[model samples]
Target chain A: MIGRLNHVAIAVPDLQAAAAQYQTTLGATVGPPQDEPDHGVTVVFIELPNTKIELLYPLGDDSPIRGFLDKNPSGGIHHMCFEVDDIIAARDHMKTQGARVLGTGEPKIGAHGKPVLFLHPKDFNGCLIELEQI
Target chain B: MIGRLNHVAIAVPDLQAAAAQYQTTLGATVGPPQDEPDHGVTVVFIELPNTKIELLYPLGDDSPIRGFLDKNPSGGIHHMCFEVDDIIAARDHMKTQGARVLGTGEPKIGAHGKPVLFLHPKDFNGCLIELEQI
Candidate 1:
């Protein structure tokens, strides 16, 4: 079950530019950018009062976000991550409810520095949902 | 400038079922549902710490979300609502940056009971962004 909105992930073509734009326009400072080699991407987090905004850009063309951008160039809303107390329990519950997990098994450290797993969009009517343990 | 995440909008085929499912699974109560004639849809809000989850369902077949669902039925994430301190200023800033406004004038009250306006996905690369004032 979703505990809270951990962060709203946005896919952008340029992470540094996006971060700077948000900072100048919204007056929101960003956290340090972090790279996740496994996901082949880098992320910068804009900390807000309640929820954080995550800006993502692919490291290369072969990256998933890059492909997503190619398909939907004006990268729309990417995925919504919900904080959960237990990733395993949440995955199992979603599975019982007929949701498909993206990876083989268990969540690994995600770009946001949390144990995260994705639910296939097919199960939730085309929305990719991320479950993270905070 | 963006305030904070007011809520994460999710498009679902069945609003009632989705609300019930969320309430039962997440142990979160539902706020009274509301409908916006302008948007041609009804919404149910599930409150959580810091952020709320909005379940949206079309009132009729000729709805924007409906068209979105037609293209991608798995009903992935919808729009992200960011509370802004001043809607007019924010809109102008986005416009100066070449973002297109979906609606003709200023923001009207949205389904979530706030002044909300949409920025066309074209500017942001394919993301329908909502700006709301709390």
Candidate 2:
């Protein structure tokens, strides 16, 4: 089951501008941008009191975020992450119940250096859901 | 500044079916459905350990969610809600920084009986953000 609301991700055309908006306008602490080669995206974290906001920009043409942005030129909410105490159990449970996990259907090292799995949006009511082990 | 993440709203074509997925498959605690005529949507809350997930369905033809669902028949994330210590201060600060607050630029009573204001997605990296005074 889902634990904490880890972070909500937004795909942005300009990562720096998005980070600046959160830092200057919202007065939030923004972290350095990191390129996730495996995910093919560059990401920055905007720290909040209770959770974080992740700003993502496509790193390469193969980046899935690029496809999302191509469909929505203005960018949009990309996906939401929820923490889980045991991600393996959660994935197994979801799979047994007919949920489709993206990629190889196995956990992959995420931007946070934790094992994460992405659930298909079709199975999750059109919202892409990411599960990360804490 | 944003406090704790309140809830992530998802527009669903069928509220009951969506709630059932969370309840039966995900094993989340689902709340009773409530109709918000002011927003022209019916909503249900799925309680999580750290935050809640709101399922929204069109209450009438005028419901804004109708348009979203018409484009995404499968349903998807509508918006995200973050708790703010002072709604008015946050609104003023956001406005001063050139962030457009949706509607009349004033907080309205949301489904949780809290004063909430929506920010324009275009100003926030294409993510529709809702700030609630908590």
Candidate 3:
């Protein structure tokens, strides 16, 4: 079952510039940055009052983040993540429901090194859903 | 600065069927139905732990929700909303940053009789953001 939302991820062309814009607009602070080499992206979390916002930027040409940036050049909202108790179970459950899983076949470490799995947006009516084990 | 995210609103063609599918998949309970005549949408909110998801269907051809549903026929994600302390201030602040505002000039009663305003998706990089004053 899905738990609470962990954060909403946004793909940006320039992480630092995007963070500065959000800080000025939303009155929030960005957390320390982390790099996920396997995903080929570096991300930072902006702690909001009730939910955190993640900013993602590509580290390489083939970066999945780069693809998202290319698709959404204006650098808007990316995906919404829900915290789950067990990622493996959630991934299986979603797959049973006919969802296409991205990333490793098994759950992999995400931006804060948390185990996470992504259900294809095509499965959820175009909304990219992320499940992360807390 | 902000209350919890009241709900993430998704524009769908069939609210009843969407609610049913979500219940079967997520084990959630959809709340009582409500209508916002001004916006021309009949909405049903599915209450989830820590957040609520709203399913919106249009009542009229000119319904703003209809526009969304038309643009996203595959029934994709619509908007993310955050509960705010002051809708007027938030709207003005966003406008100061050059965001175009939708809906009435002032916050008006929305689904469940709560005051709400929408920040243009164009301003936010294709992500429609709603602010509901709770």
Candidate 4:
């Protein structure tokens, strides 16, 4: 059901500093920071040859990233995303298998403008799994 | 400097159950578990179309993963590995940029039999980063 590894998301306290480290130190090509209101985070994509690295920061006080940052003051890996061919079918498959989907259990438009669903960390052995339809 | 995302490692309490979840529920092709005494972890790789997911469990009492699991009883994403064309160059660059390389700053043979070095999480926004020569 899962296709390619889409991107790995990292929650950061300072998005600019984190993006700058990747750009300057790692010599990586980073995209512009984008606000994802639905996901309640501002994200920047660091382009890689095979996959991308997403740097995320809280969009608001109530943002989930803010909560994550609160627990991990230094920031941390938030989630890992995998590509799926058919999001609806993937969601149904996950649901039938008893995996809890975050939010409304429906697909949401993600940073790549693709339909995405987040699987509960508990179900995936403490790692939040994001499935994106490519 | 990084070539591709090699894999994302998740520290799990039960390696067999975690591997089974990916194999049966997610319908992924999971490889057999292998012991890495040097790294002090037993790992299983779940092959995906684009990148692989590595499930890790403590190999001994002094295993780093054991400490991680103690903090997170359920399991969680431990580290993300990126491929580098020249590991020595990558290591030098990371060192020049003031990034702390873990374990005596030497490259060790990783699970894929590749030269690998780990960067401290504090330097990379709290996400443990591993660079492996492809």
- Recovery fraction of native interface contacts for candidate 1: 0.58
Decide which is better by DockQ, 3 or 4: 4
lDDT (10s digit) by residue, model 4, range A24-86: 778788999999887789999998888899999999767877878889999999998988889
Off by over 4 Å in 1: A60-62, B24-28, B31-33
Which residue window of length 10 is worst by lDDT in model 2 chain B?
Answer: B20-29
Interface Cα RMSD, each model: 2.4, 1.4, 2.5, 1.1
lDDT of 2 by residue, B44-118 (tens): 999887788899999977998898899989998899888888999999999999999999987899888899999
Give the residue spans of candidate 4 off by over 4 A. Answer: none
Choose 1 or 4, whichever is better by lDDT.
Answer: 4
Supply candidate 1's per-residue lDDT for A100: 79
Error of 3 at A11 (Å): 2.0
Order of models, best DockQ first = 4, 2, 1, 3
Instruction: Give the Å error, residue A126, model 2.
Output: 0.5
Q: Worst ten-residue run, lDDT, model 4 chain A?
A: A60-69
Model 1, global lDDT = 0.78
CA lDDT, candidate 3, residue A102: 79
lDDT of 1 by residue, B18-110 (tens): 777676644466876688667788888888888888888887657778886676665767787778888998888877766688968588887
Q: For residues A33-133, could you state the per-residue lDDT of candidate 2 as single tens digits?
A: 99998889999998877788899999977998988998887789889998988999999998998999998998988888999999999998998999999
* Winner by DockQ: 4
